[model samples]
Target: MDVIKGLLVLACAWGFSAHSAVNMQQEAKNISDLSQSMTGSKEALNTNVISPLSGGGSLKTFDRKEDFSFSIGTCSASEVFLKILTQPQSSGRLRLLAIEQDTSLDGNLDKFINVNMDADMVCSNGIMQCTNVDDFSTCSSFKWSAASDRTVGLTRVGMSELGGCYCISGKCGNALAWRNLKQVLTDVAGGISASLAAVNPYYTMSGVTVEGTQATVTGGNAQCATGSVTDLVSTTDPKKLASYQNDPNKMKQDSQTETASSWAYQAIQSGSLNPQESSEIRRCSEVRQPIIDSAKLSDIITLDSGTGGVGYCGADCIMLTLGTVGDNYWNSPCGEFGAAARFFIKDYKRIKSAVLEKAIFDDWIQILLNGNYIWSGPYNNWTGQAIPGQCELSTSWNINPNVSFKHLFNKNGVAEFKMRVMVADAGEGYAFARLTADLSCKDTKTDTIANSCSVYQNDPECTLLEERVDGVLTFSSGAITGLNPLPQSKTISQDSCQITIQRPWFNKNRTYRCNVKTQSDLTKAIARSEKIKTSTTAKDYQDIQFKNGGIVGDSGTLNFDNLPTVQPCVQACKVRKPVYPDVALDGVDKGVVNPTHYDVTYKECSVGVCPLSSGEELVQACQCTNDFAEATAIMQIMRNAGQDMICSTGIEKPL
Candidate 1:
């Protein structure tokens, strides 16, 4: 009986080995099919499958017959296929532990998958045996043999438990679903790692004030400083008047005579005085008014040199002197001297001409208008001795149209009038002047159209439509009502039966007549009639219309059935032929013995041609006739396929 039991045990052992081999073969076939579907070739299953080993060389596996292996490079349906080999256990079951490195490449073995399998290396009951779908747990004790490379190893835990092993490195697992989930998680983790690595944490925030939906941001570098005020004053004091009598070294003595005045008057009359002479006159006049008065000159009186003393002149004239002291006597101190006085002409624009009549008890005098020498006295010479005489002179100046002097006036039409006096030997040192100007001005009229649309109908704003119809009908008076009025009369003739109708304007009479030889002719005329008319009253006629026939007047009523109506002519379709020497048929040659046609055809008749009116130009109606349907179809197909798959007509075949 012991011998019989031994035989039975041996038979059971052989049967069990055979069953495991079949299961292994089936699993290998499944992996091969999956790889074939994904890589499109059976040879790609084990191609380039490598993993780093502890000793520095790569361990290439994933072959159908390899023991304890997994595929890392290829994935399908977000899952990876792994085949693990194990020894038979006493309970006919296997417990497997898999650990994988973090997909983030942090050098940590954080992801793990624990699985249970049968002795035949098949998952338990053909179901997923992984405990966790996608869970990462700390494995601090796990360390790689070589830190430089991702090494994978499978070590047997004990002699009795042969299948109990650990896959010590880089992504390894036995559950297909868990492996696929790990692949997806790995991609997500990689993206997150990249995103986190790209972030910059050193940016600074500026001040922000939020009020309701508005936000005001005040940013960037700004600086502030204290404020102060500055005052500008004139360098020269007006109260201290300069004169040769007070300071002989600082001021020059004026030397004038009758010859100088005569020469100045002759130069002005001949228009030979250069700009230098004019500038000199202005300079001498400028010092006369130490502080020019901008006020308008009214009835001038005595001129005081800021000394609070009256002059020798009366209240109707202004007195000027060379020093700060006002002259009390006409025959003043005996010395070569001069005086100056200035006043502003505020209404200079209205001043057409000015005449100065001066009564002087002095040697010579000159007048300047805004720095230009306009007139001078006759006794302006400095060579002769003083002649004690009351010299009276009258001079006039006018604005010449040929020579514009308007620019001398400022924007406010203000001008300065300066008068300078010189005493050769100090016989008399005082002078006075009376200026009378002829003021003439006229009122100007300006007319303008505020809104042009009210006067011009062609203005864009007057038109109701944004865009105008280019070819539509318009009235002869340039009025466009966008309407097509019918003809004023109509005549119909058939088989010697004539009918005439006249349509006049509103409140006009309607006239119609029919000439026929027999009833047949009348019936033919009625049948041929295409239009119907209407009237507001029996006497007064209105517009013509097309409707069912009715009573015309007390004369009679003409009614007919099945009236023949005019039918518009059908438009002729346009045909377009493909242009020769086409790009699509670049290589085509008609002279070749055997030529291929690339389905070249004409385009549809209506593709590039519009329905033209009775008088439209042919060029305007049809613009494009070179586009072919077949070429267009070919180009569209090629574009959709993302490749130039069709050969041209003229391409030569290889011999």
Candidate 2:
């Protein structure tokens, strides 16, 4: 192979070897040791904590001047926020959680501060120390001193007031811990390890616009204001993920179904069908068996009337209903099977039509009784929900209309997010997650041909069960949660897209930045490559349209505040190339931009008429590329940072 290919091979090898050899537990312990000593150390300190994968994380610094302004309350276990920061990372397997803490210290420390260490992210049974030992030890004075720890809730505050102690206190600036440069270098080279994002608590951006220099955003709201974030960074290589081989659902299928079926079977042993609401209770588990084996169907007639509310009895054990249709709640019976109500609601026809069509049906209804997402779903198996008066959604949790929740993240290691926000607690906060992965799972079932998974794939009820087992099935979720998360700046980068255009007329000043946003579905993110635009205009100083209150050429470049609410033309401009009529590079602005100047380009060609049969040329076009209709006059604009607008009016001839 060539030199380039050889380099890649070597690089990949180095990454694997370094990660495989290091011990995560020891690395964390070492950092803790160093942080404990940073309190009184004389060394100048700088603690660098980063998340290489996910965004919305941060590093907080508390100088000797003050304690955190917010009073960390003391509570038991009501829903609270969580924040975790991971050290820089390597491959998927070599991941590690750096620091985990509640946004508010209101909950009792679970097992001395075990984080979301469930099957998803691995809950450490032992206490997870929160103090940044390496961070604190960087302090020259605090490094050499001894360490002291005080625990309140899940957060342990490590204070090293004396000198000499550095690496143990878990605080930065201590002389003993961060006195070496080589160590920091090693840490920087490896990358971030592990972390997570919010579990629920959809923070809504109550509909309102907050204007800014670059863009307008949803206004501040109470929902997202309470978010807080704490982060961590490490240097050692991380652990790898274990691959699954077998279907996980097989065990559940073997045990859970048997148990459930037996319980239903034993209920009939009582013999007295009238045990409780006799008819309804009997039909509850009784009518479901025939449809599973595909022998019959439900006739859904008079749907608008009431038949849609009841369940259906199909062939074999396949019992189809509104709530338990496709991958919905398990094919369970819902609603009453008594009297005229059953006659009007039983949806037998709909089931018959569905079975013939092989349609795995799902129905979701979100009504605005007032103005809210009266949260409902594709209930394929339940009744009384769509029955206007008997709808169960009305009784469910109230979805706040004044809220707008959004999850922001980049698949790559770098990410950031921001919002004009105010929580029930604070003004605004932000979180930048890095190094995120699926630690554990819930019902992550594997399937095989012997498992009739694809046949019932559309059925939500069967999804958790019918999906054959190839490995262990488990519940999983994110490891960290950022509350009131906002941001100072967002970093966007992409190598896939690259476009550049240079002006062939006159040079102009400009500015550029790459743009990225999560798709409307929020599953994947879309990015616009580096955008280069001119930021200049001939008349940066313009006046209001004679409202009997305007001046011209003396506005000192519109600042947008005094101007009408109109969209600005462009964002950036750079005058680099001199005026060009025809040269190799006279096309787009791909060349280096001039922040404080303008780049002008020009092009000239003979144009009259195309060479007809008599050698006569006819047409109003020249050799202008990029397909511009009017090359004689270009838009006029001045490139200036302080101007109200970047580009000028149309058809302004260049000097």
Candidate 3:
């Protein structure tokens, strides 16, 4: 959505038919409209910011072919620029300014250039480099994080090599003259691209063969003649690319990493939390832990990053891992305890700063904990020492004196809290549970709708229990008795620590219409063992991204228990019959309505062709493509069939 618009005056043309001028004009209008439509509140991202220039625009509805992209206005000044080139996805909503190269806004237009995005990281001097993890150490990752040094893979990617400059009205070309996306550097010692230059570009790529993990770029543009080839002539030195290839690998991978809280340290940094604000994070490294500790759990849980994410702490090797704590039982007697975290890794020498917006289990998680009939929520408290105000039970229920009544926490710079709870009952002495105020655990699918399933557990008599749709635990048996007898909530936290009142195993919705996740909804005065959330999907996932440390690709993994199948996504737009229908040009296309086609006024591109140009383009891009196995295999045959080519795109959002 973020992009730059420039007017082009056709001059020299190459690699394309002599129709550049007409095509160029049309492309300009298309790109401008697209970029303008996606710039602010209308952007595809969950956290859509409104730029004044965007005029509070509406969001563009994207299909599966659609991708999230916004060009940088400050390529040389901020980390946001680096994020685009290194790691291209954001699991959470973000403000572009957080990663801007220069907050000062004192640079010229040349300083603010548009970097075209594709499947790869376009390196300086025309050589291309791409990785799933964010390479925070590279200057290309961050314009001025360190002094510009070519040996560090920090220099500007060669414009000629990137290969998309406009040449004369209708022609396009690549800046670097290689067969495809990879350059044909002679001194680079026979790149994989070298042998495949003449081959169908996608056929020669290093890693596109794998499914759900790759996309490609080809050698040609809209017009068969113009594209990367014409753009490569502008480079002053041909071997600049060779020099880059010679640099030794700057860093290597490391061993395992450690994170203290339910939200690990590395995850914290990756999330890029700002500490100066009200809802800020503090340091545990600086504070001393009680030397004499009792609760100790061995490390069983592993934390790290793979595709669609960057490791925080700048070291490419390190990943956020929370060593396994407790045993399976600790996972949650009823599967209540949950956790999630975000990390922002950078190459610069600085501890990763991240905002860990953990899920607030509230009602959905409550269903699991109380499925056995225990109603509980946050206590009445507060802490005055912290910069941000914390809402906690003021009295600590007068039960467990050792557990503090309140603690400080943050949420987007606004004061927030993490609560430690206790089970208040007639029989129990004063059993207090240690709960993190950290909002890391999220795993609830719907806050409004219950997603409980049924299951049987324990060695006692066979009991028929309903697994609260979350797939966590089972509550009372239909035939009730001792462990089966009914119980009710006594009272809930009467203070600011937002708590929820729930009756254990009460399948029916809460008494009030409001909610059961927070204290405000406890007016009915009930009791239940307040259980903490265990994953990042508990609170209707409203404020959460489908992605987390557990997520792997653009298509998020499924939680059959939390999320269920839905009907195919479809919306029909009126077919626009071509203004001037074309007579039969190809046998298959003869007399076809072809109502979807648009004309070209730009001399830069080809008319009557698929929007896509190559296999790589067909695979990963947002454009309607012929990449479907049967469709693309057929297209390949058609390519061999020669001359009369025609194609159609996807019709809907698939399952």
lDDT of 2 by residue, 482-578 (tens): 1110111111122222222111111111111212232244111111000001211332322212334542221223122222232232112211333
Candidate 2, residue 139: lDDT: 21
For residues 1-655, could you state the per-residue lDDT of candidate 1 as single tens digits? Answer: 4334433433333344433655655675677555443343333322423332222234444443444423331111111111122222333223333323332232233444343332112210121122332222222111112122322233222111221112211233333223222222222222222222222110111233333212222221111001111111111321122223356544332233333545555777675355323211100000110111122223222332321222333322322222233332333333334444433444444433233433334445454545675444454342234433444322221211122234454333324444455443333333233333322112122212233223223333222211111111122223433222111223334332344333221111111121212222344223222111222222222222224664332222222222233224322334333233444556756576644232222221132345333333343233334347857998887686644443566564332
RMSD of each: 47.2, 39.5, 36.2
TM-score of each: 0.16, 0.13, 0.13
In what order do the candidates fall by lDDT, top score first? 1, 3, 2
How far off is residue 581 in model 3, in Å? 3.3
What's model 2's TM-score? 0.13
Which stretches of candidate 2 lie above 4 Å from their native place? 1-80, 103-450, 453-655
Candidate 3's residue-wise lDDT over 1-655, tens digit each?
A: 0111100101111122334545655666566455443441223333343332132333233322433433222111111111111122232111111111211223211122233332222221122233321331321221111222201112344222222111110111222112121221111112213322222221112222211211221121122112222223232332332333344341111112213322545767685454333222211111111111111111111113211122233222222222112222222222223332222222111212222212122212111111121222222121222212222212222222232222221112221122222211111111222222221222222223232211112213223333221111122234211111112212223222223332222232111111112224531212111110112231211112224544222111212231223324321111122345555665456456554553322111122222332221221222233326976787877676553333234343222
The local distance difference test score of each candidate is 0.30, 0.23, 0.24
| C-alpha-based local distance difference test score of model 2 | 0.23
Q: Report the C-alpha displacement of residue 284, candidate 3, in angstroms.
A: 17
